[model samples]
Target: MITELKNIKKSFGSTDVLKGIDLTIEDGEFVAIVGPSGCGKTTLLKILAGFERPTSGELLMDDALMNRVPPEQRNISLVFQSFALWPHMKVKEQVAFPLKHHRFVSEAFKKQPDVRVEEMLSAMSMSHLADRYPHELSGGQKQRVAIARALSPAPALILMDEPLSSLDAKLRIELRYEIQKIHRQFKKAIVYVTHDQGEALAMADKIVVMNAGKIEQIGTPQEIYYYPETPFVADFVGKANLLEGTWDNDQFSPALSPNVSWHFPKVSTSFKQAGLCPLRPEQLKPTADNQHGIEVEIQNVQFQGREMIYTALANETQLTIVSDADTRIQIGERLLVGT
Candidate 1:
């Protein structure tokens, strides 16, 4: 393991921000911490960067205790959400700042400091803006410079606290790909904190879903989306329609409409009682010829480019469904819903 946070806890006066967060990051692994606002994800990232000390538990980096280590001596780089760049420094100077502070000398000392700065800026496609100050650069350009500075130090670990959240939609997508490319080139362990689930699903090798102050689940993107361990995770990670029902005889019967039930051939016998059955929006299909399916009325329809979102009502239960845009369905129409 490259870094391990063992039972870490943090509190501010009477408010508990992090409640015993335990996570591990391997060498060159990209791990994303995702949750809603005020969930302590940023606080966890700060703790890793040594900006905030934990209330209890241990922080181990390569088997060395880092509880008392300062942010400067931790050998970790942080890229903030706001892109903290000095206003007076040019792009070249900003990228070379960390290298100069750490007294980095190139192998054989053959290249000048400006030469190294050019290489970094070139990698981020910012070489053309070398002499530009922060005020002269766009939001995306500033973000690129911030990333270049963070990577110039050659740190073992990098902590990014929602670095792409401040950019526009198009710029966010562009910078996200750039960050992923940089990670592949540098092979540094990265811990990224973000509230956007789509970003986490697209980029993270392992995802950590947190709620309130504790971790709800940690797994690969496929596992987190398909087999959520909790109802909150099922609803938060993706669009899932949770049906409150009773399980018996290898079938789930919704409590609101006991006459309608879904057959599950693989359900365990222990859970043959009351529980929630989570079904993805894409899993629910509307059929016109299935007589055994539940009858529902289409309440609303929305066109979403590639797919159509439908809201339906069945025995007072509202359910959402996603189907191909070519699907022939309309509002105020009665249809059969099946799995």
Candidate 2:
């Protein structure tokens, strides 16, 4: 493991934020720490980056104790949600800030590895913007420059705290691909922090889902999305229609009045009894490819051009569906919805 936290705990005044955060992150793996606001995602990141000292427990990087190590001495880089670039400095100066801070120049530093200030800009496609000031650049451009600066030294690990949150939706999507490209290019371990589930799902090799300072679930995007291990994970990870149900024979009978139930092909790993059974919008459809289906009333049909989102009401339970079926929906019309 590149980074390991054993029984990690932290508190501020009276509120205990991180509670026994035991995690093992692999080398060169892209990991994301995600949760709602005030969930200590940033606090955990700070602790790992050696910015904040944990009140108790131990942190190890490759089995070396890190609780005593200083921030820069830890040799890890952090990229924040806000592009914390200097307004006065040029792009090259910003990229070279860390190197200049310590004044650690050597023959090997001059000859370096694959990473350089120019190469970092080239990698992020921000070479032209290198001469431009921060105010002159677009939000996406500034974010790219920030990422370029972070990756300039090729640190062993990089911490990203919602680095794409400042960008527009289109730019966020575009930069996500670029970040992945850079991750592959560097093959460095990453500890990313974000609240946006879509961003976490898109970028993370493995996701560490947090809730109220505790880790709810940790898995790949597919595992976290399709096989949510907790109620929080099921609800928070994505848009899920929670159907209150009871399990029987690898199936669930939802507590809806019209004797509603679903026979899932497989059981969830953490299928708590009489709890919420999550179904994504795509799962509940007007027509099922198989025998299992639910009867519902078409509540609303939103014309989204490509794949339309259909809303249906079934036994007082509202269901949303993303489908491409050529079905004109009236408010009170009945429809069979299942999958």
Candidate 3:
């Protein structure tokens, strides 16, 4: 493990924050910590960076105990949601600030990071504006500068706390590609914290689902998306169409109207109770030729470019169907659903 945290706990007066979080991050892995607001995700990052000592746990780096090290000595870099760039400094100067402050003793040595500034700027496509001040850059450009500065220090790990939340949707998408590219080229371990599920899904190799200041589950993106271990994980990862059902021997019998009867492959054990089946919107298709598909009425048609969202009503339940733009359907038309 590149970084290991054991039985980490933090509390503020009477309220508890981060109740015993044990996380181990491997080298070159992208681990995203996500949860609702005030869930202590950022606090965990701070602990890893040695910013705040854990009220009760041990942190290890390369098998060396480091519970009381200062933030700068931990070989960790933090990138914040707000691009905390010096407004008066130019891009190159802002990026070089860390090296200058540390007096890295590389000014007189070759094969040092002084040669890395231009490369970092070029990687982020900010070389043309290297001499420009932070105030002269756009929000996206300023964020790139912040990222460049963080990577310039050659830290072993980088902590991102909602770093892309400040950009607009388009820029967020654009920078996600850039961030992934940088990760591939640099091969540095990253611990990203974000409340946005989509960002976590898009960027993380492993996701740490947190709730109430503790980890709910940790798994790969696909594992978490398809087989969520708990209701919280099911609800947090993606858009799930939850249907209450009762297990009957080898099948699931739904409780709602337009009742669904789905059969699953038999398992070693049996569970029969009121449970939820999380179906993705894409799983429920509208086809006119199936016996298992329920009959419903098309309530609305939203023409979003590239795809059309078909909303239907059945058994007093609203169902959303995602189809390509070529799907021809009118409002109030009849449709069939295959659960």
Candidate 4:
């Protein structure tokens, strides 16, 4: 299912939640929408799932308009963050419910719901606990059952709204891989909504970064991380430090380091116009070469297992740099930072 939204706008009386959203989801593509709270990502997902109507714009599925269609009429499955499973229904029955009641269920699934339910539960590794109720299962197992139920009917598109947010960090990682495997095996288009940048980077084929009810940028993970078009995207997605600079065509001279000039041709015009350069923490390194680097004073250090995070100050401007764990740099020490 190729889903497209054109000039979609949503308003709640005086407040505008979605200010003209334009996006497309290709067939079998995994797209993740990431942004901070109240960025309208969840509202957008609701619009796609037919739970909310757009104030003005076209919602198209395979070139057919579906703005007025109800949630049950749309050939889509939604997996919620809260795991909306019935307490009385067992795992197998939960999986079987969709196959029996969904409007888009396959003939084979409807003909033999028990077999389909068993197959779905087996795929999710919940076959052994098929008789357990939601309250009897662990959090991970309950979410797995929810996923199995969503996938049982074989919908054309799957919409997930922070399905892993309620789990622990380790369990979240486990479910991310599971979701990826399911997407690959089912070949269904998935529109995932989350605020975690790492989740979008790790799982999404295409990433949409939204801010203040508007899309800041849309690209692949590498493109969004390496070549951010806006300052918000740079800071939000990659934790980039935006330095004050003067741009002379492709060359940029930092205000703090006047002698150092970097040639960046791919930087967007907005950054150049603002006389700023965005550099990620990993892009800058400490060096002793004063002539080619900016001088900074190390203020603090945090030691992780494999790397060290340093907070440094250059001309009163704070900066963050990731360095090797073995490098011996003390607090209040002056160091030259260069790309």
lDDT of each: 0.86, 0.82, 0.82, 0.92
TM-score of each: 0.92, 0.91, 0.89, 0.98
Off by over 4 Å in 4: none
Residue range with the least summed lDDT across 10 consecutive positions in model 1: 102-111
Worst 10-residue lDDT window for candidate 3 reads 265-274
Task: Please write out the lDDT profile of model 4 over residues 46-155, one tens digit for every residue.
Answer: 99999999999999999999999999999999899999999999889899998878998989888889998888888888999999999999899999999999999999
Q: Candidate 3, after superposition: displacement of residue 50 in Å?
A: 2.4
Please, what are the lDDT tens digits per residue for candidate 3 over residues 1-339? 399999999998888998999989998999999999888998888888778888998899999888998886777778989999887899988877776654232453224555678878988999999999988999999999999988886678889989999889999999999999999999989999999999899999999999999998898998888767666777688866666667767676666632567765531131234366666666777765544666778888999899888888867877777778888789998767775
Error at 63, model 2, angstroms? 0.7
Q: Which stretches of model 3 miss by more than 4 angstroms?
A: 102-113, 248-250, 257-260, 263-274, 288-291
After superposition, the stretches of candidate 1 with alpha carbons farther than 4 Å from their true spots are: 103-112, 256-274, 288-292
RMSD of each candidate relative to the true structure: 2.6, 2.6, 3.0, 1.1
In model 1, how large is the Cα lDDT of residue 124?
A: 95
Q: How accurate locally is residue 285 in candidate 4, as Cα lDDT from 0 to 100?
A: 86
Ten contiguous residues minimizing lDDT sum, candidate 4: 283-292
- Candidate 2 weakest lDDT stretch, 10 residues: 101-110
Candidate 2 stretches greater than 4 Å from native: 102-107, 111-115, 257-261, 288-291, 325-328
